[model samples]
Target: MPTTRNFRTRRRRLSWPLIAGIIMLHLAALYGLARALAPDFTAVVEREVVSAFTVTITAPPDPPPPPDNQPEPDEGAAGDPGRDAVPQPVTGQPPKVRVKRDDPLPRASSTGTANQSGAATAGDGTGAAGSGLGTGSGNTGSGRGGVAVTKPVHISGSIDNARDFPVPPGGRAARRGTQVIVRVIVTPDGRARDCRVYRPSPDPEADRITCQLVESRLGFRPATDANGNPVAAPFYWRQEWF
Candidate 1:
């Protein structure tokens, strides 16, 4: 029992540090409670603890990929996969175009029917075939298969007889053997317009006389072809003085 008492004394002496730590812990707890009761010390302590341990962890950056050694695209090449191939023309087909030939005019059959014979033998005399104004039939009316006969144009005009028109030094008299060509457009109303001397006479007086006659007294019923249709046409007249 004496040995056990000495061992307990030594054990108590060794436990003095633990007892001091416990006392310090109790004193700190008491001080915290007092501060908390006095003010908002628990909120301040929580804010300080949060600030002390605040951390931001960032992820590392990724490395760049290796470059491929692909060839550059050809600018002129057809690169699209969906595009259709170029079309090739088919062989053995003739090109589309008109073929020209120099064929002669077809001749009428001499041994045709009686109607063709009659047509060939229709136009006889009266300057019909020579004038090229015949309609085969001898009818002279303004209808089908007939000839259109226009009325004769009547023209009269006075000439300046006093004017000698100045003869050239070595040439003949300007008034002698003078001729004028007059062009007149005959309208459907039997009236003329656009009348002028297409060919001038040697004498100025003859040209002036021809122009006055054409402007004043030129008249015509509209000309007609074999079809008997009235058509506006241009007519010419040559006036001559001996």
Candidate 2:
């Protein structure tokens, strides 16, 4: 009878590893099915998982610099309106002029003619009338203590048959005429001092006679200095004898 009871006396135990394996296999199959149904499902799940652990922060940009500020110039208070059109009176002191002791003093001309210094001015009418520069009925270079010499010395030589020269006979002067020039040094008193033949004639006798005639007949008005005083001057006298 015991042999006839060949029934199973051993009971099978529960396998926990097989059950965990089966559950993992089912999860993998479900993931595949989700990828097939919606392709972006895995990506969305991974983004949500990362966002839960990560923190993000943003900052604002800086502001620009301030602008420059400057004051404008005033136009109403610039300058005077009539400054350049009208001449203004000088307010400063005049400059000093230095003159040496040896330098001559400047004097105004009394003659009616212009001199080296300045123009002529009218004088007191006393002498002969003058012509040219200013209106003055007076002689020039005749004033005492004048500024400059307005006129030079003059020579007067005239031939007179009765008082002057006598023609030489039987000479070259009588045939072709003889020309003679003499240098006469005049005194301050208007008299001849030294008379010498400057240009001689072909005839020596004519030269001698001409010089003698110059010393006697030639008259001169003496030259005046800057002070209007008479001064000695040289005169060249020329004459022709027939």
Tell me each candidate's TM-score: 0.30, 0.34
lDDT of 1 at 142: 22
lDDT of each: 0.60, 0.64
The alpha-carbon RMSD values of the candidates against the true structure, listed in the order shown, are: 21.3, 21.5
Best by lDDT: 2
lDDT per residue for candidate 1 within 1-242, as digits (tens), equals 55554343343354888999999999899878878696577678778999999998999889889898999988899866887888898788788798786654336655544433333332454434323333332434222243345532534333444343344444555456767788876654565667788999766655666676665665666766555556456777777665
Clashing pairs in model 1? none
Clashes of each: 0, 0
How well does candidate 2 match the true structure in TM-score terms? 0.34
CA displacement after TM-score superposition, residue 69 of candidate 1 (Å): 75
